[model samples]
Target: MRSVSRRSLLRGGALGVAAVTVAGCAEQEPRQAQRLAAEPPDPETMLIRQLIAGKERTVALYSSADSDRLTPFRQRHEAHLAELRRRLPRESGSASPASSAGAQADPSASPSGAATAGSQISVRDLRDMERKAAALRPRQLDGVSPALAQLIASIGACEAAHALALSRSL
Candidate 1:
């Protein structure tokens, strides 16, 4: 084995540190890119995007329902989604509500296990989801445009009405 000088040891140690630092930075770059790609640029637009996503998920839920009454309700969500998409800024790219909403519209997207396998969703579950969604609208109003705020309120009212209708159906 060759004798190792102190300078050589120091150089190897520095190179190892440099290599680790570079590797760490390289790993972080992709994660940063992914985060930027996944997150909406503005909070207001993010809120609208979330609402559109929720409506799409709701539509998916209603679509999977066995009842004829749910069909009109599902259609209403589709109309809401269309209107929401129309309100989204053109600068939003393909990140517009329509595309993003569809991407997240799976029934499994619901947090409450409301759309489980082999089991039909209960009317109570629908009511609960609508009620929760409607409750979220007031909180979403502060940072949005007046027209968007009005639309959110209207949609919340509609969801509240849906909750009542679902309650009656149960």
Candidate 2:
């Protein structure tokens, strides 16, 4: 075998270093992307998102109900959603967690359309959902800011009132 020249050896060494550098940079890209993707949402934000999703589900349940009877109730949920969004940080993306939950929850709310196809909503179903949502609020108070806690409490009160109102309809 012919012996390698000093110039050729140096050229190969330079190429190897360049390749290693490029590889290192490429590896870091995915790690950086993973870090961004896995970042946890703040507690307050998470709670707010959950509440928004619940309200959206409530509104969806009313969609196929009698407009004259449920329209006022649906409007209250809309107002709650608006208030929750207003409390969120401005930097928070426009894509609310409600949008994602709405897609899944709306379809399942009236699975057979048996309940919703009728002129009236199932008051029992609405009351159950409202009760569950209200129950969740107390748990959500943990780790939230004082301001957020107050807001959550108010929302919970509204949910409780909604459940009572629904009970009256039955």
Task: List clashing residue pairs in candidate 2.
Answer: none
Model 1 is weakest, by summed lDDT over 10 consecutive residues, at 102-111
Count of clashes in candidate 2: 0
TM values, all candidates: 0.67, 0.65
Q: In candidate 2, which residue ranges exceed 4 Å CA deviation?
A: 1-34, 94-121
RMSD of each: 8.5, 6.9
- Across 1-170, the per-residue lDDT of candidate 1 in tens digits comes to 99999999999999999999999999999998898788755866666677677776777677667789788778888888888777766776644545674444422236365464246777777778887877777887897889999998998898889888888988
Q: For each predicted model, how many residue pairs clash, with residues at least 3 apart or on different chains? A: 0, 0
The residue-by-residue lDDT of candidate 2 on 1-170, one tens digit each, is 99999999999999999999999999999998798659866766666666666566567668756567878878988888788878876654634753436323322223232454344557787777677777767877888899989987887798789889988988
Model 2 is weakest, by summed lDDT over 10 consecutive residues, at 103-112
Q: Give lDDT for model 2.
A: 0.71
